[model samples]
Target: MVFNRPKKRAIVESGDGGLGLGIATFIANGEDLGPIIRHSFESGKPEALMQNLRSIVKKKEVEIEELCRLHYEDFIFAVDELCGVLVDAR
Candidate 1:
């Protein structure tokens, strides 16, 4: 695990598949991702690449105008919300 923890936040913005806030910080705050991402792959540890990616998505989701919105709060880790109908396609 990257830093030995389960990161709860997301890295890519849900809005338009763009980089999230943590990305700038991740690149500018310290080690650049180019090396980190490359190292894991070159060292024969692909899992570490995914694990270390958590660092760039460590911030809480922010509301963005003119983009699709998701009810992150409604998410239940291991439970599925059973339903039989779809509505509100606005």
Candidate 2:
């Protein structure tokens, strides 16, 4: 049997390694996130939209190792919960 190379799962699995601006730029310029942000702004939820955007990039002085090891599904849940906090803050 032949072995295969490791797939580049980190980007797809970790919000593009958290340097997700390229993903954001692509989405903003392409068909996904950019459109969502546009719609959120048009819907008079600009503050909420900005809050969600901030939630995506929010960093702490110290990141918990548990968070650092989270898989994609878990990470999404964590971020969604975080967005909830930011939305509530508004």
Residue-level lDDT tens digits of model 1 in 1-90: 457653444444324233334444455555356754564567676664454456434423232321224544454422344232223332
After superposition on all C-alphas, the RMSD of every candidate to the true structure, in Å, is 16.0, 18.2
Model 2 lDDT per residue over 1-90, tens place: 999864333222223223234334443344356555565557666666566457545533134544666566888899999999999999
TM-score of each: 0.30, 0.32
lDDT of 2 at 35: 56
| Residue 35 in candidate 1, Cα distance off native in Å | 1.1
Please identify model 2 stretches exceeding 4 Å from their true place. Answer: 1-31, 59-90
- Estimate candidate 1's RMSD in Å: 16.0
